[model samples]
Target: MARTLKEATLTTRNARAKLGEGLHWRGIDADTHLGYRKGKRGGVWLVRWRVAEGHYHRDKLGAADDAITEGTLDFNAAVRAARERVEAVRREERAKADGVVHSVRSAVLAYSEMRDARLRERTGSEALRTASSSALERYVTGRVAGGNMEAREAAPIADVPLHDLTEAQLSEWRDALPPTLKASTRRHISADLRAALNMAYRLHRTKLPASFPMTVTEGLHISRKASAEAGEATARENQILPDSKIGEIITAARDVDAAGSWGGDLYRMIIVLAATGARFSQVARLTVRDVQADRSRLMVPASRKGQGSKPEATPVPVGADVLAALAPAIRGRAGGDLLLTRPKMMREPGQLKWVAVGQRPWGMAARLVEPWAEIRKAANLADDVVPYALRHSSIVRGIRAGLPLRLVAALHDTSIAMIERHYGRWIADGLDDLAAAAVVPLVPA
Candidate 1:
């Protein structure tokens, strides 16, 4: 039952006495503040009640003259409002905590409030989120930051609250991704956004929407197996360059004289790729220390996927031409240095100086290759033949030259199974070479 004004006064007086001056206990009707007020007639008990923390203030409800008299202040009405306000506050707190639907902007603010470290720990700190963020920065930010659901934006669903994301909404956004995105690339975006949302919910459990949803099937219908096959076909087609064309490219590169050295770095880099069968990024990221001059080995410290983990440097030996080509770059190898890399591109612009031993700039290289491609096109070469074709040609040459599968695998720093799967068709008929190299007893020694 609600207290009467007289009852509330008595309660306030007792609470004030216990708590001392200036402190008051909360009651249904008001929060009473107690103190002594200096008056013309000396001092008197000054009592006041604040109906709400900042919303309402009442001076003890009744005047000092009426304090000992009627003390009428509609105490019941005040109590009811206070009770309703308290319940409303409780509801808001519960809704926020329970992950009820919030505006996208509000949800974003809540997500940003969590510390990165805390969120990572709670979500197990998967590296994919970092990669996803990179893709987002590249594609999503510029378009969406302008506050438009522009059709050109990749993954428009990211603009919606993660918790409120539904399959239909995801589908709409999926349809909005660039038409050029391969199924694999689309899948990657889906997985990336999923990881981000999942992490948000896990780390900020109390603040996320209670029923967040996602679906990878929204935009594309290509199966993972089909995508893998397409990728494999692409890889195989890339590696099937003619030996005659390879000789022509070599000739084109060698035509550059030492006085100019226009094609020197470009030529040598291509030779290394062919001989080493290293991924373009792998070759680009190589530090001086990664090369073993004495052993003619190309060491890959880590793949793009396995970076920040332990370095997995695999050593693959190269032929003399490649050794000679690379010799210029490795001329004065000091202890502990990068053999090759495009660190200039990796580092933030304006933060580092350009160095010869630094990493290769992939974009710049690709642009440079345009003229090369035009030259090849003039020669009626296949359009798919690229710098990576050197790597593939080297593998094919190794198999054709009667190298053992194990040795080929070692030279390429890949599995025997991979060598067989990729180049076995070209080498399968050459088992006679394998037989010739097989252990045959010359004598019973």
Candidate 2:
């Protein structure tokens, strides 16, 4: 027996309530249907369309007009809205099949592809491109680790048609983001999405529908209060170590390598990190070719800056000790090998070995914490000290040594504004020079 969906009366509040709790769908045409799902509070409208033979896609339209509420639709309105939605879906399906885009997911994917292509051309390393993939998966197309815990059942917003996207829908997505994520992390994800959507709109404007919400500018950020809180937390957390203490940590790392615990892998990496002041991720992405051992410089990759092969990568001049530590690894490995690798043997075994026999890239940050703790304890440093202290201390050292803020920013792959914002306290180290210059030829007066 075949269940036939007849034309049902969903006009009045009484009529909808009688249709019952489950979805009551009525065929509007051979290919489209208008649906109403009864609920305790109110009923809701839904629409489904057969884009292919025997294959249908469904989407919620809005609330059914059981009451006089904003956006609640009457029978006629529901019919119009449902047909519009069905048409939008069918149009996008045709366009998508033909390699065109009108939906949010399609726009985001297009932007990502272009961005990765640019990154590949600029850096000649796929690390940035790889990072973009991870971000898109974690935050956009997929969900985060601790996604909106309450509403875990919400449909992924990735497929929301740009024609259907509204401020409320986007804001709903933002509010539904994982509450556990740091404000800064949330902000970054939001900014990345906004940038992607905006980029797509600029590059493919003609492909977009009239209802395509210009760019993703509405409600796509953490609040200013949240941003301020994150800034305060960053300032509180990042501790700067002096050169003497950094030197002690290096020596302690060497001792750990001698004990066969780290096998000199971490030891060499620490040297490069302390010497170059690059982010852990940036340094970890370094290839054997990046090591200009002959010139005692390392071509550290800048993080997501400088498009199109222009930003020179600014070879960082390192000390003799850094060169000496690197020479052993540089001598044997090919130019494409990772400059740093996870150490072999047991740092305490019984764990699954992530590092392969031939390929050993740096593992997770949490795993590195234990190894760094050993060196921190050995150097008699505070428990709070971590690998990032190397970068912070280096930045601080440059500031205290009266290096121009611009130069320091360029060297660290950060902005001058960041230096001024986070490490402004250290910039006062130039007060003595300022005071001396202020005195000038006052004796003549």
Candidate 3:
């Protein structure tokens, strides 16, 4: 028997209260119906309508007659609200299908694709592309380490709808980032996300809300604070080892080598790092040909910062003593042989093998080893002394030795601006030379 409109429309509370839990005919549309379920407040009315074949979208219309005895909801009004909700959902689904920026995840994906296309076309530098890709990865899959402990377990908001994203939610995510990350790094990541959002709006040509990242600038207060803190920390903690400290570390490295722990390789490696101001990656990739050709200069291959098809043969003037120290490795080795190889270590059951120092487990040749923890402990150096500190020490030593800032920057394959920014205070010590050279006794006026 078919339920009629009169049968479904119960005007009084007492009459509708008799209807039990399950789908009840609304007699409004073929797909529209009222679902009744028991709730804390007696019974609840759920307005459900089929948006597609075998797929229904439902919303809570209001409490049933038993719960809403004072002010009962009319059947006609409830049906109208249900229809409106279904239409809204249909619009959202259609927008999503049409790629009109529905969700944050979708927007990020689209932006990433655009970025990759740009990278493929060589529209941007590799470094910029790499940084942007890293930022995007962190954004989609929340950063695991290097942030505040409280924020370590926060859920990724990649699935969040773009329109539904609130400032409070974004703030929470930003606050949860690793407290250890530099302020500049935090700022960069934020900028990347903002760019992605902007790209989404532009690509989709959708009318974004005024609260979008491009329109809003003041909400990222925590990220800005973190950036400030990082800057302060960098200034305070930039450790450039003194000459005496460098000598002490060298002596410690020699002692470790003499103990047969790993022979004199570490000592030589340290000497090369300090002498040339070359990065660990650059030094590790050197061949016998690089060392044998020039006693005064160590040729650095195309590094992360280097721009060219061929390797950069940087002229870093080294003393004969440094060359003498490296001679043992260069002797009787082919030009193609690695200048520095890992010490022979017992693998399993008396199988001793020498591994390439630059060999990465993942087969990436460009990875640099920072064996600072063990070396620092052996050298009795400060905990803050990192591998890059050797390069800083070298730059400082050159500046203090009265080497021109331009020459030092050239030797290190960097800019005068970078040198000044990082080691400007040390460079100031050599200004007296400039002052002395500039001073000329004035003729009788």
Which candidate wins on TM-score?
2
lDDT-based ranking: 2, 3, 1
Give each model's clash number.
12, 0, 7
Residue 135 displacement in candidate 1 (angstroms)? 6.8
Please list the C-alpha lDDT of all candidates, in the order they appear: 0.52, 0.73, 0.63
Error of 3 at 207 (Å): 18
Worst 10 residues of 1 by lDDT: 60-69
lDDT of 2 by residue, 8-114 (tens): 77767787867767778888897788889888888889988775677778899888778766768988888899987776665565456656446667766777888
Scored by lDDT, the top model is 2
Cα TM-score per model = 0.50, 0.62, 0.52
- Please give, for residues 1-445, the per-residue lDDT of candidate 3 as tens digits: 4334333544445655666644455544777766555444566567777777776677887765565555645555555666766655654564577565466667766777676665544322333334566566665544456545223332477776765566776676667667777777776666666667666766554444544653324444434355444554332244678778777777777776666555567788778888787777577767778874455767765455523354356767777888888888888879987676646444555657543343211111122234556567877777776778888878877887888787888777778987876666677767876678889989987
Regions of candidate 2 where Cα sits further than 4 Å from its true position:
1-156, 178-181, 195-206, 209-214, 223-225, 229-231, 235-238, 305-312, 344-359, 363-367, 429-433, 436-445
**C-alpha lDDT of candidate 1 relative to the true structure:** 0.52
